[model samples]
Target: MTGDFTARVTALLMPHLILAPIALPMLTAGLMLLLREERQRTKVAMNVVSTFLGLVVAVLLLVQAKQPGVQTSLGVYLPGNWPAPFGIVLALDRLSAMMLVLASTVALATVLFSAARWHKAGVHFHPLFQFQLMGLSGAFLTADLFNLFVFFEIMLAASYGLLLHGSGRPRVAAGLHYIAINLAASSLFLIGVSMLYGITGTLNMADLARGIAGIDPSDRGLLHAGAGILAVAFLIKAAVWPLNFWLVPAYSAATAPVGALFALMTKVGVYSILRLWTLMFSSGAGDSAQFGSQWIVGAGLVTMCFGALGMLGSQRLGHLAGYAAILSSGTLLAALGFGQNLLTAGLLYYLLGSTLAVSAMFLLTDLIERWRNDGASLAPHEQTDDAPFLAADLVHTQGLNLDEKEEVLIGQVIPAAVAFLGLAFLACTLVIAGLPPLPGFVGKFAMIHALLNPLGLGSSGGFVLGSGGWALLALMVGTGLLALIALTRAGIRHFWASHDRAAPKLLVLEGLPIALLLTGCALLAWQAGAVMRYTQATADALHAPGTYVQAVMSARPVPNSPGTAPGANGRPQ
Candidate 1:
């Protein structure tokens, strides 16, 4: 009886388990909508439970993804028992599973952080939060371009609410700009998707991969055009230079928790790029292999340089974090442009570590600024008759002072709170600067090592350190130095420059989540070997598009009735 019960439980959950990541938050959001507005605590409890369950489900999926028997993307779920390329499908692979895990972790952290105050700042906060998670999870797990678009809209709509939560004039203005740019990008998304369908007759990514190689020579130009247009939309969303002006302003204006969540948003665009490029333009695609590679590298290099410089000039910590996000995106794009499996492996690890650190930076920025708002700033603001050390705002003119307020007071609760903030800020600095003994340093070191010694890591062949590799290596080191100098200077100003320093009251909810995210970085460092192995395996799978195509296109629909579907189909739905 116990064995029977265990078997029954496994049968019920295992088949549909992949859907849980996407479905749980969606159901939670709907349930939250049903609750009356007065039961705020109940709503909070529901949100937390749902998010925690989603994270648990994501981890389980990751474990299954690593299981044997599949070339890639372990679990493929077709809604309503429809076949692939004909119906909505959600699939999981090492890469997608990793992303799902990352998104869920960020969701849990931000939600926990919000519980302190941000959630209660506006109505419908709980529902919107769940909706955002639903969208993010769906985006990561989706198997087709159409569903990807749908999830993007879902995510953006919720972000529209979250970004403008506790609306003020600053938020309103930034929110409007954010909404307008994304709306335009969404338009481009539709246009590009339509073009791809017109050319290939399918919107399923795996299907496209299989179909693109067999297309007529005459349609090659159109295919590239369609993909280029689509890339423009992604590039805009990813905050590449020349189209990234909205990122810093919009991200900086958001509340702490919302801003922390937004840390993962740009990565979605980067993920989209990675997914499409690998599937459609991998080395196997004959003439189309590595299409537009140079442009991607150029854009990434420009964005990295821009972000590094912008960060140096930033007086506000919020802006610094925003610029750091742009820098991370650029790094991924540039590394990915190389199209080497080992390089891809390193960047994947970098992506995870950098995103966590950047999210922590956003949270810490809010805390430090709050201290300034509470008149506990250690730095002097403006010129005084006796001593005028001159703050950054005074030195760089008023333009650098986006929202830095000048206040001064010494308070009692200084020793402990200030120490915590100081240590957290220092960790953020170390991570951002790619200093030793953190996952950030490990990630960068891995990428550089892979680039310089591809054959040393059991590679099947040799790689040339071309001009591009040299350039990337130089920028990686240079940017780290710049970040260290800028962040260290900001730390000194925030923690020691002024005599009116004090510790402001930090809620347990607020401090705990920040510590949790940083602790994640610590764990990543401690387990770097295992994490790197997983990432390397993921990269190997991604570079082989044929495996992805075979897996996705061969997936069949689950039969509901004898006549509805065939039972002997490939990759049981």
Candidate 2:
């Protein structure tokens, strides 16, 4: 009887699983808002449980998406049982599922890390965090453009709260600029969406793709203009080139865990570009096909160059992490612009690895800086200890006793805490620099190999790298070198030069997240073959958007001239 009951419950809940990732967090955030700020413990507990549930659901969704058959693997949930192109729908395919999982993983880590101290730094941190997760999950899963704007607003608003959580001068100042910039971007977003709706009757992504081919000739220019404006908004959010100036200060000033969470925000923009570009602007887009490809590629390359220069020039670790995010975004954008599905598969892998590395670095930066300032002495230290004695001092010391002269220090001993920090820092450096034996390296190698050999295995055709491809190759290697130099300099300054400082007390809560993140990168490296296959499959699905369109549109009943056919739950059939 118990077994039968369990089976029945599973059957009942199975149909609604697609909504869990978004709904769970929204409900948790609402519950958290109801609680008083004094209920800190309760809020933390709720936050953890909600994020964990989200992670579990995302994993389950990913598994479902990776099933043997295409239609069976994709999951589409229509609220109120309403048909598509009319009512809201949430679609989960391979790409969306993968994004859901990645976002959840980062959200879980940030939440865990924040519980150590950041939660207490503000009154509504937990609620804001959950709301941010809701926004991110919703953005990933929503099938309509208007809802994407809604989710983007949710995400930006939550981020604004979280950015000002600690309330320092730098944080507030940066927050103001961040808010202003994003508000402008939001305005442009609305304008573009309006224009898009004006050109195309529907906001549903699949439906928009279906209608683009039949759009009137006069409106084609407007559609392209709308798309250009939309791309500008996304590119700014993605931290591409001059539009990204606000990123460094805002991200650097944010609290550590919030900063880590911000690492995923840029990817949200990149994901939007990928999803929309591939779906609505592919070869089947008629006059709109491959629109702005050259502009995207050019902007991405320029963004990468700027990011690399920023990393090289940045002195603070926080600032460096911000630039690292810019660099990662640029790389992914460039890959997308290339329009090679295989290369995009590798970029997906790169995106996952880079995001994990950047988050780990953000957390690690806080811990290191905290240690650097803790119990620091006010007295001025002797800077000339290693310098040769002055002539007067040398003469006096020589006359007194040659043996009594102060001896110069040989080497500094590495402390246990510093050693641990050094090792973790080294791992971060390797991952960010795309060094050997790490997932970063694997991803970059795959991209380069794909560029050099576009035909894949068993193909006899020869290929030549385009100028853009060569530029990409050079920038990839150059950025890695630049990162290596910057990170190495930071490690030495923090760990080696300051070796005499008291060892930092490592908290399990603080260290555990960083360790887990790096371990995840390592696991990705270990399972590269399998993960690459999955990413390739995702790439294939993205390139062929028709399958996705069919899956989503087919689920809805054909509408009559007046309205959709009447169906169950008052929804049109």
Candidate 3:
């Protein structure tokens, strides 16, 4: 215990390690902005650096996973080393590490896919992407509410630019709504933080988690209200249900790769909900049943229903995919809302599967868009060309129109790539739909098992069931069926239909990203045990808030400070 304390305190006081993840990209972005030579090379360099950084971050996250509850901070300059109540702190733990890894992986894939377009457009793409990453990583790591706001702004501001990167009528219009809604959500987030700070007298998440209980009951209402408001802020970011009106248009209108990247934006909000609910509001302090758990479930189910219906209703392929992404998010949030330790474990794994699957699909859509028969340039704002080619054009579209020689040529060039992508997405869909032999299936099975378990269903306690559980079960089955129907329908149309016309072959640049994502899904299917264990541990930790409070409130001896002596349970003497 003493050693752990010393290490925690020591980690806090130490200089930042490498700072490679944030620094290298920011530096590259700077260089990209200034140096105009070899645009393609510059873009390639960006993708390479981002990929390298992701690998490095994954390693660091793995190292951190070895010590889940311990607090660590790398950047000292952000909050000037102030502890707890007075200044900013960026705290990393098991959940944040998981999110960081997922975000980095997705970001790296998106950047790689976008490489082909960046060179042609001559945009300062690299720096914006780097900054976007910086904001996302910082959001997960930061422990201070105000600083969370800061990073949120940084991320959204960067996203605003990305959404409008190569702007046009549709993108500009969609970006307006996206920006307006998020800006409003951001403002609400700040307001909620201020109210919580006023009541609890602290802005640090750990400190607030520790202090939240002692506040007056009325003041606790304010805290719950604050938490609820914050939940809305995140839900807006997550695009949960009615509040999610901005998502489809925003996603469909933005660059395909950019939309793929933003698919993660919703997860960030979900991550925050998981982090804060577990860390701060698990006890009777916040009417968690009403605010923390039930509401999320309700919103999630609504989101799922809405998204599935939207997908069924939409004719546009990109919009259909966007709705599907939203539905997957609802499943995640609803699982979290169930508030069962097992369900949370399920939520974690489901998150991984959905993120990888959605990301791969978005990139694939971008490639498909490029292959439109009109020979029309895909504008920055358009999902893709809407014109339909003759059924006979499929052969020509395969670049096989001229001769057997041309057919061989085209097949050798990019048809293999397209075939690989289609199969990958189909695999992902199976996972997403909770079919067997995939991690998504495992995750859903675990969640359903938890829901049906005797203890949770009140077998011993006389038919007692949590409000969120039934709704969640309904959502799980309901959404799964809807997704199955919708995706299968779309799949048959695109891959199996007998048509003479084929869209042009997509650029080969996206091959790596698609491969990376599909490989991740396969690995997750193979090695879900470790992830499920971590998720279980995380859920258990959240259920037992005492473990967290004890860890954060306890103090370590400062080398020369008189007040640093060990006290009860190593808390300040």
Candidate 4:
């Protein structure tokens, strides 16, 4: 009987696995709170198992999302069984599922990486980590504005603890700044959400889209005001320049695993803009159609340029990674503004590859810096380090060091750890720099192709590019070049400038996450064809807002259990 009960429970829960990505971590985190501090091993085990299970569920959802057809592929789960617009709804579609997979993948890898030593830095690390995942999952899956705010707060709240996980004066300072900025943003979030709800009777995103389309012309100004305020909150989170001063210091100060996972935080902002803008302002939205497209595109271009310049100005690996992330956000935001379906597809592809590369870069920075610290350090202008920096040092090439330096030009043995880090760094640089022969290059190429040849990819109609097209093309290439130069400069400084290099002690746990992230980048590049097809479909679905609305708005509440009348308990007749 017990076995039968267990089997039945499993069967029952299987259908609700759509909610598992969000709910699993919440339950796991709650259960973990009961454990004693001395049982850190158990906490770690629970954290890892829960994260791995979340990854499995994410992959399962991705498979379902990939199945062809709108109604079939778009999975909607009403938590309260009260239908959309009336109660909480969780959505699983191509876009949200992809984000779930990405979040879970990063979460599992970072948890494993932290297991090496980082998680021990602070109290409640395990629970905070799980809560962070829960927030990320919910933000992606939530089908309404209010729940998005709740999840955003959940994410930011947990990040507050994670940011200061390994506390130092610098970390505390940066974390405080991060918290203050986000808190302000959250206030704006609440105000905007409230305005939206007040203006329209519902906070459901799908219903909001439907309402916005038929909204009176006089209220358009108020509507735009609320959305603009909401966009500011997202832009702040996305680290759009001038508003991004806090990001580098905070992220750089985070522990390695935390820093890596924090890479997804900015993307959540980008994802929100993508979901709402596409749904609420599509071609079918009448007057609101493409309303803020120009402004977003302009913001994106400026952000891209600012990020590239910031990268060039950055002197450290952590700073470089932070700026690289900002650059990615700009690129994605800019692509979304272009209002082309094929461009959107390429942007999604780029988003995945760039996210992997940036996350790996964050992890790599800690390892490389640790290794550099273990090595003998010399001032760049100091007489001993001339060969690595001076063009004269390049011209004065000699088989023997002029001073018989410790670094031998003739077959110096590199530690396996050093070699591994170097290769990973190289991969990250290529992808983040958007260089050739990788998905980074392929994704951009696809975007440019779609831009120059809209008809090439089956777009519904063409829009005039004016001077925007030329400017975007120029910026795309220009930023890539700037990124390449900046990363290459940093690479030489870290890997080549020093004499008597040493490798830090590395654990499998520490190394595995970086390796897996880099490997994922490679896989994306290798499977670009299949990946693009999937992204193309996603882009197509995103451009078609009506389908999304129909799916969500048409959903009816689950029926009452047997013996209950249809109209019982105030149920709709």
Candidate 5:
């Protein structure tokens, strides 16, 4: 009887795995909200368990997406058995599955880290966190543009709450700016969606793609205008330059765990751009083929330069990590603008590595800052002014103690907490700087290789790298170098120069998550070949979106025959 019950439950769930990623988080968030605010332990347990289940579901979906001989690369789910272009649809493809797993993994880590302390810093943290996951998962899975907007709003709202979780003066100030900017972006998102719906008369992404082919020539200009508006909103959220001034300050001021989660937020914009551009604006898109390619490339290059400069100028670790996120976004955008499948594969890999690295850096920064005399603030103040004198005084006070220096000192022993932090910091530095033996290096190298060997560009079957390619190559290398210099300097100051300071108290929960994140990156590096192959497959699928469109449209339930319509009970004959 128990075996029968287990089999029945598995059968019931087999078809709905696509919805599990989004639904689980939403349900958990609702449950947490219903619980009393003081039920912190219960909330934490529920959040962790939900996130773990989400991660497992995401992994299963990813594996299913990569299965060979599949009719469609995407698995589509329709609620209430509604037909396409009418009812809501959830679709999971390699790209969406990959994103789901990444988001879930990061969410788990952030939640665990927060459980150590940040959750108690405010009420509703767990619910907001779950809601944020719901938003992210829903955004990735939705097959309709309107649903995308809904999920985007959900994500933005949850983010606003999380950003203000700890409630300091700086956090409040930054949170307000973050809220205002996103609200404006949301308004633009609505305008763009309305315009697209007005032109196409449909909000389903697959349907919109099909409709674009039949759009009147007279309406083409309006379609482009709407897409352009939508792209602007995405670019803002992606932190494309001039418009991204709020990112550094907001991310830096946010609490550690909140900042870690914010790392995934920018990627949402990048993901949206990649999805819509490939689906609705590919070479198959008549009259709109590769629209705004040059603009994206130009903007991406400028963003990269700006981000590199920001990293160089940043004094605090938090600010550096924020700028690094922007740099990663710029790199991915530029790669997409190049319209190369090989580059896209590399970009996806890099996206995963960089997001994890940046998130880990946020948590590590908080841990390291606890031991600093000035705490986490990077502002120039009196303590900074007296730094040189303090160094000199310390040297005179301790280094020249001849009376007590009769015995020679042996090797200096490091504390467990300090050693762990130092090692984790080193891993983060290598990953962020794209150094060798890490996934960061592997991804960047793949991108540079693709750029150098452009396919079918010359009579010899290989093309010389363009001026733009060379410029990008130089920018990537220079950016990595700058990151190394900056991080190395910071590491020495925090760990070596300040060795005399007491080690920061690290909790098991906090340290475990950080270690796991870095370890995951290392494992990715070790299995780079298999991971790249999967990413390359995802890139191929993205570039050719017919499978995605077909899967979604075909998943819609068939209508009844002309003579066999709905009966009095509304049941189909």
Candidate 6:
């Protein structure tokens, strides 16, 4: 028994071993802002540092992969010797590490992409960008809910400045909406936190988990209500349906690098949902143990349908991508809510692949626009000699005479590249739609299998909504088909149409970032199995909350930070 306990503790602490590796770039970036004398030197320094950060995170993830359990919880630093559950605690289980790696890679790529142009306009872009990275890394690593909120606010505040970097009317307007919506969500987040503290008398997640395990019968309703309210904050962040109006405008208005960074924002919301559901509301080992996750699945189904529809209808390329991301988020939520281990695993892979692909697309869009603006095209605009070729006008041209090589290259090479990225995203959508051959199909299949079981949802906690599963399946298929059709049509129009006028040549600086992203996406396709294994392991960890509580409760207390004593309700006791 003692050996088993020690093994669990070791498993929980393993993930944090690489924290310093990840934090190096963030600290360097911050320090450079004050010390670096020249803008050119500072930008160069930031790029190298950010790239190093990515490499470190990649290494950490690789190390974590070699380990079996993939769990780690860091008690407060014990700075000056403090006690834990009271000190600032940092934790990195499978989910946190997965998210950290994703965020790190995306940030590094964007920073690399922006290296040449970030400081072009005499702004302190490097420092702000570095701070943003810090905020993101901290948000993923922190275990405390309040600290998570603080980190989120830090990121958002940095994002607001970054979004309005160029000082345009559209960007300024979008920033307002972004700020307003997020502020509202933040308010609700605090309110939910207050309610939880008042009732449970503890804020530590592990403590809250133990507390939730033994809730009073009469207070369960109140606890559920608080949970529901807290969920609303995350939903708003996730850009889930009915609360997703802010996503399109905000994403479209931000620059490509900014947009790419924003791609990780939704995962933050999903992370909270996963943590809360797994730790606080997990089903127990009894005939009566049903946590009512079907509601989450139902929400996921609707979100998937609505998101796909929105993506199809969007006119602008940026807005289309925005809608597509929302659709993807919906699918992710639905998959997790589906309450099948396979589906959760699928969701994990889909998020990783989709973020890489969409982020690349966002960055690529900027490059395309820049190339068109830089006069790399064979045919310059007849009327506006100086301005970039109008994207809409390019589509309006009827036909053009081109050499065979040009035809092959334009029709084949460029489209193939774009198509490759599109397919990566399409794979993600297909998975969301629960299609076969992809993880999504596997996940959906598993979910259906679970639901069909006699003792599963159909048992005591079951709500008999006739044909609900079939209806959801039909919606998934229909929307999946529409999204594919829409994407294919757009691809044909953008890539195949014979405008005869070359828009621009690709720049190494502008194009390489996306190329890196495409490579990662392809790798995701290749390594789907390993990715799914990680996801399944993560889901298993989530389902079993005892391991998490035990690790935190038994860890050495940090000096000056007192343990949260259990309340009268047996919560945290």
Local accuracy by lDDT, each model: 0.85, 0.85, 0.71, 0.86, 0.84, 0.65
Ten residues in a row with the worst lDDT in model 2?
Answer: 564-573
**Stronger candidate by lDDT (1 vs 4):** 4
Residue 503 displacement in candidate 5 (angstroms): 2.0
Best by lDDT: 4
Candidates ranked by TM-score: 4, 1, 2, 5, 3, 6
lDDT (10s digit) by residue, model 6, range 1-573: 999999999776543454553366566666767664466665666656766656676557555644654333342232212234675556666777787778878877887777757544436666667767777777766667777788888778878888887778898999899999999998888988888877888777877877775777777777777777888889899888888888889888888888888888887888788877767765652321335467666776777777788868865667667876787787677656645554455567777766776677677666544533453334443646534345434433635433533232234345444454445445444443445565545544544554455245323223333465565556656766766666666655554555444445444665667767766666665677677677767766676767766766665642222564432111110
Q: What's each prediction's TM-score?
A: 0.91, 0.90, 0.83, 0.91, 0.90, 0.80
Please give the clash total of every predicted structure, in order. 1, 1, 10, 0, 0, 11
- In the range 294-390, model 4's lDDT, one tens digit per residue, is 8888889899999999999999899999899999999999888877898899999999999989999999998888877774433345536455556
lDDT of model 1 at position 569: 31
The segments of candidate 5 whose C-alpha lies over 4 angstroms from its true place after superposition are: 1-8, 69-74, 374-410, 456-465, 558-573
| All candidates in order of lDDT, best leading | 4, 2, 1, 5, 3, 6
What candidate 6 gets wrong by more than 4 Å, as runs, is 1-18, 35-38, 65-83, 118-122, 285-295, 370-468, 558-573
Task: Give the winner by lDDT: 4 or 6.
Answer: 4
* Better-scoring candidate (lDDT), 1 or 3: 1
lDDT at position 491, candidate 3: 78
Worst 10 residues of 1 by lDDT: 403-412
Model 6 clash number: 11
Error of 2 at 361 (Å): 0.8
Question: For residues 472-565, what per-residue lDDT tens digits would candidate 1 score against the true structure?
Answer: 9999999989988889999999887654644667889888888988998898899999999999899888888677777777776654556546
lDDT of 5: 0.84
CA deviation > 4 Å runs, candidate 3? 1-15, 18-24, 37-40, 68-79, 284-290, 372-415, 454-467, 502-507, 554-573
Tell me which of candidates 3 and 5 scores higher on lDDT: 5
| True-structure lDDT of candidate 4 | 0.86
